[model samples]
Target chain A: MFPPRSQRILLAVLAASALLSAVSGRLNPYFLDVALGAGISVVLASSLNLINGFTGQFSLGHAGFMAVGAYASAMLTTTLAPRLGLSANLLQWVFFPLSLVAGGLLAALAGVAVGAPSLRLKGDYLAIVTLGFGEIIKVVLQNVDAVGASRGLTGIPSHTNFFWVFGSAAVTVYVVWALLNSTYGRGFLAVADDEVAAEAMGLNTTGYKITAFVVGAFFAGVAGGLYAHLKGYLNPGGFSFDKSIEIVVMVILGGMGRHSGVVVAALLLTVLTESLRQTGAFRMIVYSVLLIVLMLTRPQGLFVWPLWSKKEGRP
Target chain B: MNRSVSGPRSRRSFLTLAACSAVLAGCREKDGDTGAQAIRLGLFGALSGSEAGLGQYTDMGATLALEEVNAAGGVLGRRLEMVREDNRTMAGESATAVKKLLSRDQVVAVIGDGNSGRCLEAGPLCQAAGVPMVSPAATNPKVTEIGDCIFRVCFTDPFQGAVMARFARETLHLSKVGLLVDASAPYSLGLASVFRERFAAEGGTVVSEQRFSGGDKDFRAQLTALKSAGIEAVFAPSYYHSGGLILRQARDLGFDGPMLGSDGWEAPELLEVAGRTAEGSYFPVHFSPENTDPLVAGFLDRFRRRFGKPPTGVSALAFDTLQLIADALRRAGSAEPPAIRAALASTREFQGITGRISMDSGRNARKPAVIIGVRDGAFRFLRVVDPGDPGRASS
Candidate 1:
């Protein structure tokens, strides 16, 4: 099922460089813009899928973590890229992905801080907490000086394009999907099924829960970093509860806990939002109407995938 | 406009009017399938959302300008066709909309992004594409700093802040000042920063300062602090919604100081919310309908006939922006983007409905601001200030 390790690395390099070269040409800005948006959505949905779908954390503050990651990454690139004084070519190759990593790691840390307290809560209560946390993040960013306050940090080098977004998306899917297949991944499923039973079975449910949040936070951070660079702009207004709800819709519209389904849903919704530009004033209204129809028809999502290839429900 | 006094009109002017209308009809019909001979322009704004009003007014201004151009036998024998895009008032979304205009619709010159945030977002994209974009009312200084291809027709924040500061210090002749700034708003903060700097530079003392966030209903605490400071006047650079509430609260605390504000106090809600408390408030603005200049009156009548209402400051600036673009196109003698950019940069003493606009090196418009006073439930034009030159503070 797997290619040889050296060959896989060589293929990945070839694909990335090819994408870069293609984008360097007069790639249709219209299609590239919509496709880049779709790629970011894919990352966000899949990351949120980890906590809400696989581990059953049901986070409503995914946008807050995204904001943190975006601001952190934006600050790094805008500040450090200039100070490095390197050639433009070297800067793009070296510092671009480094900022994303920096953003993701910071978001993972934020997950630990917030998840440590609120993980004890369940269901709707947890949702409410996460929602509040999201608003708090926006407010804090607005008041902070380093991030340009409410004006938001502009002049961010527009580095996000097809290669970085799709590559990061691929990495997010592989890491999450691979994690879900490990022995520790079984603990996550057990916790989601029943906490009491999983605890009685000697599973460290709390540890697994935190792991899910950190992992989810990491990819969401990556998504935020890409988003910050894609628009070459960042604003707290873009990361409100509306953003969180939009991501949740993408997750639920696909099958919960289904990675491939989430990717498809993200692509569909992103492209739809862009393609409906011709609808004028009724574009968003039409988007909502279509989504409602989809929900009413296929409530469990378009793709329903079993987590494991087994007949039994749980361990 | 010149009809004969007698029952039988003169034939010469009648023929001219008929020719004008026919040319206008031709311009309006140029959007037909041929698609070859017309110059394509683009317009983008908050076409739908909470701020849709601004976008609608922008469209109206451009529509009027286009009608004038088309009526005058079109531009270089090519009728101007606008490819309008609704930016939806988001930074990334506006960029995407402009990108579509650049790639798909392929507009030569773009105008719009009435607000600063979206202008800042879309400016660099236009620069990269070598398209000229002129913002009608983006007052933020950073909008033009993106590149040479980006420009705006409104006075930047620093100029606006200094205008208000000078008015509060020289025009109103007040020395001791109290400042109230909204910490959460970029406009308010930028305005407050400059007002503070220039107020100090102008040798006026700022006795006390207070801060509040947007949507905070209660301002008694900040008012009490400013009132107790015994300042002569209060400068509250905030939105009308919050400004109205703050005025009410300040009065309840018995601070009768002269309350000054920026264009954020443009809405009518300040009167409804603050009631009689809103009287005597002073603020700097882009346009006032009460001006008696012939240019102002002429445009006012045309705007009324077209949009069914007097143009607000936002719309007036937008109208001037389009006229300014048309002026540049006429001078450049070509539809090329780079040539248009050069022509726009060299514009000086261009008679817009608002005022004469000249471009600075930063691509920001060097223009004067009008400070108006609220008296007897109406806006009274008070004084005009040009902050770039202190000698021309009032003209």
Candidate 2:
């Protein structure tokens, strides 16, 4: 067997190869687009996992962060694109990176504001507060006249591509992965294990929890920003509670806090949902049934086997 | 416990490796192009969920049009293949669907995004990819306003709103109107704005304006307020999902005022949901089912035979959009996006089931609007309002 470091290098090389193949232009751009969407979902699901999985705080307002990111990035790009007066190709190269970071920062700010108030509560109360916050964001976005209000913000120059989406996803995965391995990550796990013990250990449980929440929000915001550029339109309805739930589902089905699990879930759910289009009204019924059954049988998720499991006899 | 921690980390690394391999496989599959014979045209709309009926109708409409075109020896002697995707009434999914159609399926064109918001989301992706897309029923002007590549067959909210507003004033003699709009819906909010502007400009008073979200079933509070406003007419610009519920609740609450709405309320399910309450409710539709024009008659027969129901305005619009696209492709003699867009723009006097369509500078169809009312459990045609007048009263 390869050493751990060699395995990591091999994985990175494989990922790069896969991404290059996606960008090779000979393949249909549509699949590349789907891959891009999967990438964005990775960012959203993994970020959400930080709060809902590791920190043991449930949030259904990830879409709100997405909205903040989308609008902020769109406005920035719109302003900078004209002033910079770069060619479309060059402009895309410069603006996409900047917009993504801007989106993440804005989302992190929103996360702090929402997390500070709601993290004080527990379980269902946090859920309700977060849900309400999501709705409030939608309403606020709808009423903002400068961003086109209910009519929606259109004419956004499309700068998002396969490279940008996948690159962001890689960054999101790396950051979250690094965070999960650090001391702060242990604080998060401690809180998830038992809040009282974590607090007793002088972990500043509130601060660590809020940090996880903010980090998750930041990535969701980045995803949203990428989404806006990809679609070239932004509307309040695009970032509702349903959207938040979708990200949550990805994390849950992928085995929360498990990086590979989330990635698998995002791709599977997207394709499964799309493929079931022919089922008409029964599609959601089937989806609900599948989810329920999965929950009942394997609550630990399809990917319960961790990456480094030492169970010698297991598959 | 320490083992558990290490276990997850190592497992995560392994899983990442596996994910990377899977993605690599996906990329390889993308590179190996199968030289597909036919020109793939994508059909995307709400195919499931709450708006499945709309999606079904749109698919039927597009399919029929494709059938007719194929019967006429196909476009440019190459058979047109439709790659369909269901948006499921969600904007995010709609964007994803469009991307799949454009990038994966390699469709030259796309059609059928019934919801305004979905169309709005899909429009940019099409523009970016230089894919020509013509939505059959998405009437929000913002869809086309995204870029030159995005176009629609139906008239916009402004035109439909003006038509309904004029119908309320001239036909129903409703001078004082109450507005009950879905605040959460872009279509409703947009239609309401135009309706208010046109209604007030045409010597009509909007006595009160009330709001409800898209999924709100109980509209009694808003209806009660509108009722107390002493309005002769109520303009509820919303989809059939909430529109039917509102109309039923309003009738049950004994507020029997004439309800006026734009094209959003032109679904047959409105009658099913609102039942007897749907009677006397007027809406501006792009096409009336009562039209005896030979082309419309043929369309109705085919549609009824296929779907086992009479075609609604949405289906007709979808049908017209497909035909329009086929017509443009024929005229352009190529499926290239830019050529198709130019052909679409220059299209004039093109015989469509709705009317003789001529593309304006904005690429919107210049067609007459029809006012239809529900009577005897069916849509009864009132009259066709001519273009260029905005349905306003002449001095």
**lDDT top scorer:** 1
Best candidate according to DockQ: 2
lDDT of 2 by residue, A1-315 (tens): 766653464457447745774654675555556666767787788788888877888899999999999999998887767897778877787877788889889999999999897788888999899999899999998888788776577767778876777667767776776677766677888888899988898888889878988999999889998998877778788788889998888888877666667777876676556555546557778888888887776577556654444442223
TM-score of chain A of each: 0.92, 0.90
Query: Which residue pairs in candidate 1 collide?
Result: none
Residue lDDT tens for model 2, B1-395:
23433445456566556655555545554344445657779998887767888888888888888888888888988888887887667766777778777776778888958787778778777878888888887776666767778777878877777777777887788899999988877667877887788888888889999998878889999989999889887899888888889889989989888988767677778989999999879887888778777888898999888778898777888888888888898999998888888898888888888887877767677777888888998888888765355423110
Per-residue alpha-carbon lDDT of candidate 1 for residues A1-315, written as tens digits (9 for 90 to 100)? 899443364356448635664644465676677667777888899899988887877899999999989999999989988998978767666788899999999999999998888888988999998899889999999778688877678889878867787777767766776677667787777788788899999998888888999999988898999999989888787888888998999999976776656777787787777777767778889999999998887676654322322231222
Q: How many clashes in each structure?
A: 0, 11
What does candidate 1's lDDT look like per residue over B159-273, in tens digits?
A: 7788888788777788899989998787788888788878888889889989998879999888888888989888999899999998888878888878999888987888889
lDDT of each: 0.80, 0.78
* DockQ versus reference, model 2: 0.34
lDDT of 1 at B181: 90
